[model samples]
Target: MKKTDVDVVVLGTGNAALCAAIAAKEQGASVCMLERAPKSKRGGNSYFTDGAIRCAYGRFQDLRAVLPDLDEEQIQQISMPDYGEEAFMADLLRLTDGQTDQKLANQLVSRSFDTIQWMMKQGVQFTVNENQYYEKDGKRQFWGGLPLKTKNKGVGLVQALFQRAEALGIDIKYDAKTTALKQEDQLKKLIVEIAGEPVEITANAVIFACGGFEANANMRKTHLGNEWEKAVVRGTAFNTGEGLTLALKAGAVRYGQWDGCHAHTTDYHAPKTGDFNKPGDIYKKSSYPLGLIVNVKGERFVDEGADFRNYTYAKYGKETLKQPEQKAFQLFDAQVSPNLRKEYHLPEATCYKADSVEELAEKMDVCPESLANTIRAYNQAVQPGPYNPAIKDGKCTKGVCPPKSNWALTFEKAPFYAFPVTCGITFTFGGIHVSPESEILGDDKRPIAGLFAAGEMVGGLFYHNYPGGSGLMAGAVFGRLAGEQAATFCNRTKPLSSKS
Candidate 1:
């Protein structure tokens, strides 16, 4: 490959990268996207996800859909901003231990929605109302709606962004991976090693969209700690956090490390060898309070469905160690599989099943007698106001969430099932420090000239807890900011103050 130049050189080709490239091009700045992976493999694991972002506007809408009974108090419980920027800043403080620059977080949060509308104009789709308005809190609200309307929502939206990015004449290169960020005279450049040669491109702005390091297990063990490595399999190999590495090498500020985690899940469908996840892998469905989680000892442990967060393994303040198997079988009934709850995206696909408790135990690899007693005892909770202390005291109690129907499953019928499952991490919370203007920052909170950040790559800008579809919302948000801001910067370039 030959050398090239553009106003912005974007690494990675996922939602954030595509969003940034589109943003820069729309703002009239030349932008080029380089993907180390081939086009067919180019659909990074992000495509498999439902890009949840927690923008103030989006949360209000999603809450209407998922939690119809929600109110101000519930909103306070779920959103990051409830307590103040201090609570919202908690993750950043823990990640950098109060060493972070707050200016960047301020910038990303402020510009989020403007970013969303910009993408909407670019033809990226989203969900909309059935008629003229959506029902919310017993009232009607009307927003333009998401560009994509399928049940598989964000997937289509991302596809639309990809299409628009190509249509806009943005340059996208496959198999052009950047190895590092090289700085000269205090300026940043991408170092690409292609076909046994090093190609350097100095740019007005370098946007780090390369994803989190979930796939890179060794690296995960190093920075994120060994517990993460043992907890979940990587969802996207493309998201190796290479951009994060480059940003770190170039002295970019880091924030929200503690905020990021291997999104704890009932399954990422790791294969038997523990090698990279294969394409055919399917997620086993697990429902809250409906199933009892058992450890190897045939004893119930932590909550299987709650936000296990890393706290599940605090070891009373010691370094959190990996839990064995990281596997917990979800025991749901004939009804759970047929109609999984409303909030989940995919259909409920389950694992082993049997008519009798003895047979179900055989499939789950637990003692049939003990397993039978566990289910029988749990079923007894249905008749009363409170659950049996023994059953509630089990590790399974940890994962329980309200609206969770533990009593709904009586384990009473024939053909019960056990879905052997593992963990799935969606995104890491830590990312390049950026401003509300989407400007990438240096070690000291100053803008690194000619560089910007956006999407998941920019951290600590979020409100406290995740809002549904907020990740996608934020990606659109920051991508627009980066593009618009970089355009303004590029536009401001003037004829050298001619000192003739």
Candidate 2:
């Protein structure tokens, strides 16, 4: 077996791992990153995202710090309300039903803006999130407390991070899977498999930022229930719980909601696993809030207008999976068709359009009569009010079982459309416990020396539901924390000059 030594070893090459490697390198530590996937598929789940990151920005100065190109002319073109730290914290706690780990939640919310700034300093570019905004009165109005994204989504984010990593001379090894972790004396030893060969890597400190077990069918069945085994994976297929398993073997304790995950409505025909060719959340169908969703039985399962898509989308997939055939249809009329998200307009989208609701139902393989009745009931129940998608207009539905609480527009128009969708699990919420400083804790509730965790590997920040764009924010914040803490530990235990 080939043997190597490094001051820091980072597992996984996603946003978190890359951030960890970069921060460690900036701290004057010799850093090495090990990616489970091949070089062609390097970025893990981060590459498949839309790159939207949620953070607290109470003023334009905060946004300017991250989006340096924002000028007075651009600021005048959009309506971006301030997102305060209190609002961000409230959203986190509200989505998790107050089950989130208070310490981790506070850490994530407080350090979010600073972390975004740090990422910008590390060569990542930012742009306003156009998807979160709706054009009204000749101005784009941003809602949902999220307004930032990478320039070209996840692809751009990974490219920028990789460029920074290369510029820093950080060693990155693709196709290198860390299978086991061992603590010997004052160093951490990792058993890694590279090109079918075993290699021994010893590091002063190790950070696991790989991900969760969202892509593993067996693990999904075991943890997230049998229904999840059939759930489509919305991200990388390489996250099979190896990192968590290895960490547990090293005596790390498990934490968070093991049976919960960040699942959402995706096109029914989307690839079982994410398609690298069609990256950046192209398969997602988040416009249901602009319309209604019903199962094959033509029964509405959830209140599509219960809240903004950002808050409700993550938990709706489980409802879809509970339906027969684990599929549902999102229905929209000509009145709101133009307001639908760009994902709905994709040529590859599983869309059924017709002149009438009955025809649309027939095309969607649903009971035509049942669907027509459901639509009729919904239309009659819609309370008369000014329709507005920019905010919660409270244009609700009356006499409906699952009432549309906002953006209620009667479906009395031609060209009705329906989109078939299913559950697409993004990442699991459960993982090993870690301190606010990103140090992994053992079964005895003490930090394990030289072992830290970040990204999806460090859970307890999420529970039943998730706020959109917060996942990447948490990854960057915790990844940077883990990297700095690991580097400080490395320097404290072993002098950099002594390592060869």
Candidate 3:
């Protein structure tokens, strides 16, 4: 077995792990990153995302700090409302039904802007999220609280982080899976398997940012219920909960909603696992808020317009999985087709277009009569009001069983469209508990020396549902926290020259 020593060892090469590595290096600690996948498959679930990040901002000047490239002309063309810390916190509490851990939520909300600035300084570029905005009265009015995304989405984020890590002289070992962890007198030992060979790495501190078990079928069935076994994985195949298992063995206490996960409505024909070649959220169909969704039986199962897509999309996948065939169809008319997101226009999407609802239903394999009746009933229930997608306008349904709370427009146009969708699990909400400083906590609620955690592996901040863009933001915020605390621990516990 090969042996090595470092001041800090970070598990996983995702956004959180890379941030932790960079923060530790900035703190003057010798850092090394261990990736479970090969170099070609690096950047865990973070690489599969759209790179949207939520943060608190008081004004346009606050955004200018992170997006320094934005000029006066570009800023004048966009409209972004101020999202303060209170609004961010309220959104989390409302989405989670007040079950989110207050301490962790507060830390994430308060430190979000600073973390975004830090990421910008580390070479990550930001751009205005054009998709979150709508052309109203000539100006692009951003609706959702989230208004920023990485320049080229997740690929850009991971590449920039990797480049920054390389520039900082951070050591990264791909194909190195840390399977076990042991506590020594003043150091932690990690047993890693590299290319089928065993290697031992002893470090003064360790940060676990390896992510959740969304990709593990057995774990999904056991924790998220049996239905999740058939759900598609929307992210990396390497997040199998090994980090959680190792932490549990080290006496860390489990926390958060083990049965809850961040799932979304993805194309029915999307691959079981995310496609590396077609990365970046291309398979997601989030335009349901602008239309209606029905099961194969041609009946509505959820309130399509309960809130903005940001708050409702994460949990709708579970509802889709509960359908008879674990599938659903999103229905739209020509009046709203132009308002659909870019994902709807992808060549690979499973879409059906017809001149009438009956023809559309026939193409989707749904009962034509049932679908037509359902659409007729929905159209009659829509009340006359000014329709607006930028805000929760009072446009709604009156007598519908499951009412459309906003953007209720009658589907009385020429061409009708339907999109086949299925559940795509993003990440698990269950994970180990950690302190505000990102120190891993034991079963007795005590910090474990020389051990810390970040990212999806550190839970209690999310519950039943999630706010879009907050997951990546939480990862960056906590990853930096974990790294700073881990580096400080190393400085206090052992000398730089000490080795096993």
Residues 248-322, candidate 3: write the lDDT tens digits.
Answer: 998888999999999999999999998889899999999898899999999998989999999999889899999
TM-score of each: 0.72, 0.98, 0.99
Lowest summed lDDT over 10 consecutive residues: which window, candidate 3? 491-500
Q: Candidate 2, residues 1-500: lDDT per residue as tens digits? A: 99988999999999999999999989989999999899999899999999999999887566877787788888788887889899999999999999999999999999999999899999899999889989889888989998999989999999999999999999999889887788989788889999779999889998999999999999999998998888999999999999999889988999999999999999999999988988999999999999999999999989999999999989998899999999999998899999888899998798888998878888988899999899889989999888889999999999998999999899879898999999999999999999999999988889999999999998899999999999999999999999999989988998433655
> For residues 190-291, could you state the per-residue lDDT of candidate 1 as single tens digits?
778754577876666677777766666776677666665655543456677777878877778777664355353444254321222233223423243445
User: How many clashes (backbone atoms < 3 Å, residues ≥3 apart in a chain or on different chains) does model 2 have?
Assistant: 0
Model 2 residue 488 lDDT score: 94
lDDT of 2 at 417: 90
Candidate models: Cα lDDT each: 0.55, 0.92, 0.91
Instruction: In angstroms, give how far residue 58 of model 1 lies from its true place.
Output: 7.4
lDDT of 3 at 73: 89
Model 2, residue 165: distance off in Å is 0.6
Worst 10 residues of 1 by lDDT: 311-320
